[model samples]
Target: MIGFIELIRASGFAADVRQVKLVRHKGDDLDMDQLRNEGWFETYQCFQSKPVFDGCTHIVSVIGEDATASRFVGIYEVQGSTTASPALLPEHCPYTQWGTESRVFYTLKKCPGFEDLEDRVVIDWGKGALAWHQWLTDRTIMEIRPRGRVLAPFRDFLRVHLSFEDLGNLATQPTAHKDWVAALSAVGGIYLIVDSMTGAQYVGSATGSGGIWQRWCDYAKTGHGGNLRLHELCREDIARARHFRFSILETFSRSLARDEAIRIESFFKQKLGTRVFGLNAN
Candidate 1:
């Protein structure tokens, strides 16, 4: 991603100016209709350049281009504060002159007909030329180079072990899964309850009646558990930990919820080990 600052000069003292950034094509041979069809048409209009009598300043960011990504420009609006009434004196009413400074940035990507360039360039109106130049220079200095640890790449295909326990202390109901499901539904979504002290993790889903805390409490008392890998790991260390932190990483629509849950289980098994439960598919 790139960032830039822009300054615009507007007519009169109207603070309301629309900042439309656009890229102008250098070649006349290019077809405009084809470019428009690709959704690269200019979406904004530039303010009319006129004399200003009041002084006020506003800033904005703009991004757009033609068929070629290289032909893009970002814009900013700079407005001066002044009354449009003719009765005001130039000096006393204070006609303001507003000039804006804009900076632009770009990323690397394929362009069909153009030769690839090592660096993306920016063009802007000359006001704070030095400042804009410095901005670009600083960005170049801070560009990120990807490197370091590369994790096992095929984790998405793995199956995870998950475990569960009914902690309610009451007799296991005829609706074994449904009762706990009701309790968990109140909390909503999937959560990881981690016992930091024991390096243990618990992955579970809930809906409707019980919060995560209540579901865990039920698991603690009953010990009547499910045989998924994650649950067994947590159960092993249940005697050593008294506190755990619950983290909710994602929520899914009902249509995708089951698939998402399975995916989450696999992820934790590969990334977090045995503490997560409910992922066993085989």
Candidate 2:
């Protein structure tokens, strides 16, 4: 087993090392669904009996045994001893219950493998609520791990296809994978949206401005592209669209005329019987 300080140094927090503190970050269970959507947990505040805080940096470790192997979340640069709620809590954080005092607030920057971390990280106890280990040093730099998402290397971009979840990753943080989005937007193609829940399929074509990326960005944003059928289904419960899986059914030249793209789209719909028994309205 690696010592707390050594493992963190290896994780690339060494440059920003400060004296380790006994203080721990406290918070309620992180929202798993939101983590799935955003790819990382952010700025969790902690309350601890004021430990002797020096200019040392702290490593935030997940206290719950329920937390997965990537138990370490991120590093914290806590300069203050008083832990007050942020000027504004994270939009999703629930209101604090009665009789609680703010301790030390921690910025829980997520580690490299945050997604695979075991599902639960709920708050418990009092100042002892969240368990944390601190490291002390006076390094000037603390680079955030995996600064941004890299495009998946799958041999060919044209052959690229992903589930709704994968697309969500791209949409939620477009800057992280601008290359992937640009490639998709550059080409027009025949695509299919499969409803994983009912095995229904919708055949559609992308053309002109922004190409397939534009079309998919719409789905990522509203879970529907203003399509009469999808709009109705999503309106009923926006989450219903989670059942939607996206993939390329076929490909076409961006230079292909709009008429030809439409013809190909219609052909696939007929071949797949989508209009008759699927999500396609037309």
Top candidate, metric TM-score? 2
Q: Model 2: per-residue lDDT, tens digit, 1-282?
A: 335455455546544443554333333555333333343334333433343343545544433223222223344555554444545345544434211354454433334533422222222212332334434422222122233442242245445646666777778767767677777877889998887567988888998878888889888888888888888888988788876878887766787899999999999999999999987888
The TM-score, computed over Cα atoms with residue i paired to residue i, of candidate 1 is 0.25
TM-score of each: 0.25, 0.50
Residue 23, model 2: lDDT of 37
Task: Tell me the lDDT of model 1 at 91.
Answer: 37
Quote the lDDT for 138 in model 2: 22
Instruction: Name the lDDT of candidate 2.
Output: 0.57
